[model samples]
Target: MLSDLVDLVLPATCALCHRPGGALCAGCRADVTACLHPSPRPAVPSPPPPGMPSCWVTGEASGALRAVVTAYKDEDRRDLAPQLGRWLAPALRAAVGQDGSARRALHGRGLLVVPVPGSPRARRRRGDVPLLAVVSEAAGGLGGRAVVATVLASTRVTRDQSGLDARARAANLHGAMTVRERQERAVSGAVCVVVDDLVTTGATLAEAARALHAAGAAQVLGAAIGATRRRVLVPANSPGPAG
Candidate 1:
């Protein structure tokens, strides 16, 4: 309520187009939504990271879409979480569909949506793991069918992933995450989909999958709002955005 009051008084402009309204105005929102893949499909990063699970993304990481995500993640635009979470829903739906447990879990079992753990350094600088907030919103939009459960945590500090190649990222994140011991019971039989704001190199998701599986996750999949298209050679028939 207080934030809304502030927004009404200040009238912030769109982060990308800078139109006076919100962090992402309707016009710019439409353009970013246009970039969404229409339907989620497998998104495989170049030289795919080891143990990478099936991943789906809403759009390629670039243009207005990337700007929105970057603003939400790095520019302290926490207000964009709802819009970005809405964008993530499609990919999350696809991921849930792929996980047999999720479909059935809606009946009686529970589906846990987990976000990739960011390093403590990043969290301290960013004020929060923005993805977790986004994932919680996305799960709420899924009705009572799913719930957000942040069971994973960084096991040790690691170097910043920015500018790291696929190999370097894989090495840096290797065993960097683990399911908290106390939370093992919650994850043991849960159908989980590891989520991130964007997929680059697929290293983080792969490492996340490793940790989830280590804790006895019934099934593990990945979904992201966007992915980098750099050198990710998708086959002609693959229904995903690539250039």
Candidate 2:
């Protein structure tokens, strides 16, 4: 497989299980795959983070998934971008709602994928928004109708979110982002899908939605690689169908 070849050349090792082969070996990928569902599911943060937008996730953020996400976000695994980006594709497709009719509509209307902004501090530390590459890759697979746009920017400095509970997370991110004035014209009337690497309290996605809506976006949906299952509330114990 192509991934296996890349693994060999890069001397890859599994970020989760540490198996020597790929950043995520086939076994760990299967673990993530088992939880992936094509349909968009609601990710309501417990206590419900205010301003949180509706979101679809590929898997619960735990075990191998969580470890891999951490490695990508903090451990300088930029090479893992393609692999993680592929993992994020289903959720992006789910957010786009690819039923026959919806697919045709999307092909005509075009899709704009926007990554939720990371703090400048984190951006400097990590070199970029880790989810941007993933979103770009996912957008590439959407034919010629979709494009990745980095339009949101943090409006102020926010503290590290690691120790925060749901409430604190909400407080930390509320009104912390904005759509650039230059991008507002482009955002207007666009079907924007907010992309993120992980969703814990849903604060970040919520904030992204708020910024997009404020800029005149026609509609917004969220896509993520994983979300905290314990924190999110999905309907009917099943992934919700369509966006």
Candidate 3:
């Protein structure tokens, strides 16, 4: 709603189609929605890196969906965060429902939604990590079943992942993230859903899970708004209801 008001006062073009309108025009909005899978499904990278938690995604990161994510993250089209979060919510809910720790958290402790940490260099360039707010927005829709936490932090600078292959990406991120000492208690015994705006090689999410598990997280799962079309589907064996 605020984004609409902002757009009204300051005209903006659709991130995907460049049509003059709100952050995304109605037609393009439909196109993005069409990108979403009818149900969230497992999306693992081929040769998934070690510690890659079971993962799910709402859509393929291509065309309108990919364009919107790029605009929101790199082009300063922050207004699109709300829409991205809306797209991400169902995938998150599905991950929570399927993970034993997260399912139990629904009635016992509580689910923790942690955004994968971006590189420090990227933070310096962007001024802030946009995924934090995006994750907060998405987790809010979980009906009090989840709490957003920033437990993971990058331990060293890493190169941009844009041009990296799966192995290179895994090596770049390995040993890059850790749970901040002060926040370790928040992760211990928690059921965490590591949220990322997009998943390309699955290396980033895998690295994030490693840190959380090292911090004593009871279980870790991954959720993303979209994933690269290049993925290996994990067999459907979880008992949780499909999204």
Which candidate achieves the best lDDT against the true structure? 3
Give the residue spans of candidate 2 off by over 4 A.
1-10, 17-19, 34-40, 98-105, 231-243
Residues 148-222, model 3: lDDT tens digits: 888888898899887889899999989999999999988988889999988888899999999999999988999
TM-score of 2: 0.82
Candidates in order, TM-scores: namely 0.88, 0.82, 0.88
Q: What local distance difference test score does each model get?
A: 0.84, 0.78, 0.85
Clash numbers, per candidate: 0, 0, 0
Cα error, residue 77 of model 3, in Å, equals: 0.8
Question: Which whole-number lDDT from 0 to 100 does residue 144 have in model 3?
Answer: 54
Best-first order by lDDT: 3, 1, 2
Q: Itemize residue pairs with steric clashes in candidate 1.
A: none
| Ten contiguous residues minimizing lDDT sum, candidate 2 | 97-106
lDDT of 2: 0.78
For 62-142, candidate 2 gives per-residue lDDT tens digits of 877777778887776767788888888877787777434335546876778898877676699765465787789887877
